[model samples]
Every structure is written in structure tokens, then in C-alpha cells.
Target: MSASSLKLRMMIVTALFAAIIGVLAQVTIPLPLVPITGQTLAIGLAATILGWRYGTLSILLYLALGAIGVPVFAQMSAGVGILFGPTGGYLFSFIPTALCIGLYLEKTSFNLKNAIIANIIGMFISLLLGTVWLKYIAELSWGAAFASGVAPFLIVGLIKAVLAAWIGIMVRQRLASANLLYA
Candidate 1:
């Protein structure tokens, strides 16, 4: 493929993943402090399929859309306020989470094993950053923050990580086979 075509394909795929993140983010199970959303799963999928550069781009695009009041965030919430809200750290953490996941897979291999490991790491990154932010922002004790923000999501997060790894690898393989992705 030409360089220009490759860039175009990357852009298109990045945007698609951004949209996918937005759509999945709405799948939420409400909690006291942090609702369980599909955003982390989408982040894992984006990284597993798109790798670091485009995966991070997809997250940036998703955040930008929400910042611009696009209703692309959880519960259809948007604007800069959300980015600075209690859950903002989780949202902000997605950048590094996606970047690390993609970079890990890129440096190692884009297989199920690596993807699962990368997603697990990414899940912890989100939880750690988010819990800290929630503690300060919500003016809660550390134990309270961890209890509400991190503890509740552990099992579900693991499930989502595996799902993201499995589905992401399958989709990536198909895309590569169809000449839509360069792998």
C-alpha cells in the first residue's frame, strides 16, 4: 500500500475505534462511586488491534469528542467538566493504558497470550489512577476509594480483559487477512 493510503486507513480505523469506545462506554453497571463501563474493554481492544500510535490516537479522539460535548462519555455525559470529574482519572488513564497495551503487544507479539497480559496490566493502570483520583476528588478515605472504585471492578475487569483480548485478536486477524490491517 502507498504511504498515503496507509495513513488514510490508519485514520479511518482509529476513528472507528474511537466510535467503538464511545458506544461501548455506555454499557454500564452502576456502582456507588464508579460505574462499571465497557470503556476499559474498548481501550484494550483498540490497543490490541491498532497498536500504540493509532490506539492512543483513538483514545485521544474519544476524549476530544467528549470534551467537545459530543455525549460520547459514560451515561452520555460530556464536556471538560467530565474530564476533571471524579472518574476523569480513569478516562485520562486510558491514554497510557492503551499506549502501554499496544506497545507491549508491538514489542512482543500480537497474540492472545500477550494481549491478555497487556490488557491485565492496562486494567490495573486504570484502576490505580482512577482510585487515587476518586479519593482526592470525592474527598473519601483511601479505603473508601479503593472499596468503591477498585474492589468492585476486579472480577468484572478481569472478565473484560479476557474478552477484549479474545475478541480483539480475532478481529485483528480477520482485518489483516482481508488486507484492511497490516498487522
Candidate 2:
């Protein structure tokens, strides 16, 4: 298929979203085991807007930027070494989480309900990776990891998922009306 000029726009928006994600992710609420932040919300929004390939690239870019000590990450630190930290799971998980959200929307309409379902599923993917990393990297037990890494964020996760879905639908509507999408 031919490339769309929208790629350029997507790149700009992706960068903006990455920065937003990084900034929003700063307010980490420490849990009994892991910490929670609004990073997933940014991931969801980026995926919905950028689609799979660019969305994944955007997250990877964010990670790479952080790795270079750009302070573009949640905790304002950077480098591959930070991957061993407590919140590392969520950071790594963002790539695949974004892929899932973007890929799903590529084939289907992104309604609020569908976006919610997609974001929930994507978040589950993120939580699974994050929790596993918490257990391994953080040297926590599985039970404890689940309790801390996943449990406390459940309610807020749901809320973020809903918000992501709603935001996706709204953006889609706006794009369609403005003829920003393929006409």
C-alpha cells in the first residue's frame, strides 16, 4: 500500500504524547509492592492515534530517549540499567501494549466500547509483563507481586481504560469530520 502523508503528523503527535506520558507518569503512587501511574493512559492514547507500527515505534523511541539519559521517562532517569528498576515492567510493556491497541483499531472501528475492551486487554498484557518483571527484577514473590503490582491499580486501571476508550472515540469522530482520516 502507498504511504500516507499522515505519517509525518503521526510522528509529531507521537512525540508530543511521549512527552506527555513521561510527564504524567511522574506522579507514581507507591503501592504495597509496585507503583502505579498514568503511563498506560498515554500508551492507550498514542496507540489509538498513531496506529500499530508508528505507535510501537513511538513507545520504543520514548524508551530509547530515556535510555540516553534524556529524563523523558517516568522517574526522570534513563539508560538500559533502569530496566531493572521496580517500574521497569510497565515501561517495557508499553511497546506491546501500544501494538495491541493500535493493531486492533487498524482492522476495526474504535468505538468507546471497543476501545475500552482493547485498552483493557492491552492493559492486561502490560500488567502481566509488569507483574512478572516485578517478581523477577524486584525479587518479589508471585503472590506479593500480584498483590502490589497489579491489585492496587485495578480500579484506576479501569478508569484509565474507560478514559482511553472515550478519548479514542472522540478523536476518531473529530478526525472523520475534519477529513483528517482517509477520505
Best by TM-score: 1
Clashes of each: 0, 1
Model 2 clashing residue pairs (backbone): 67-79
Please report how far candidate 2 places residue 111 from its true position, in Å. Answer: 1.3
Per residue, candidate 2 scores C-alpha lDDT tens digits across 1-183 of: 234666555566667777877777776776654567777888887777667777787788888888878886665667777766877888899999999998888778766767888899888999999999989877888998898788888888889888888886787578657655432
Candidate 2 positional error at 37, Å: 0.9
Span of ten consecutive residues with least summed lDDT in model 2: 1-10
Q: Write the per-residue lDDT of candidate 1 for residues 110-145, one digit (tens) a residue.
A: 999999999999999999999999999999998999
Model 2 TM-score relative to the real fold? 0.88
RMSD of 2: 2.4
Worst 10 residues of 1 by lDDT: 174-183
Error of 1 at 34 (Å): 1.0
Q: What's the lDDT of the predicted structure labeled candidate 1?
A: 0.94
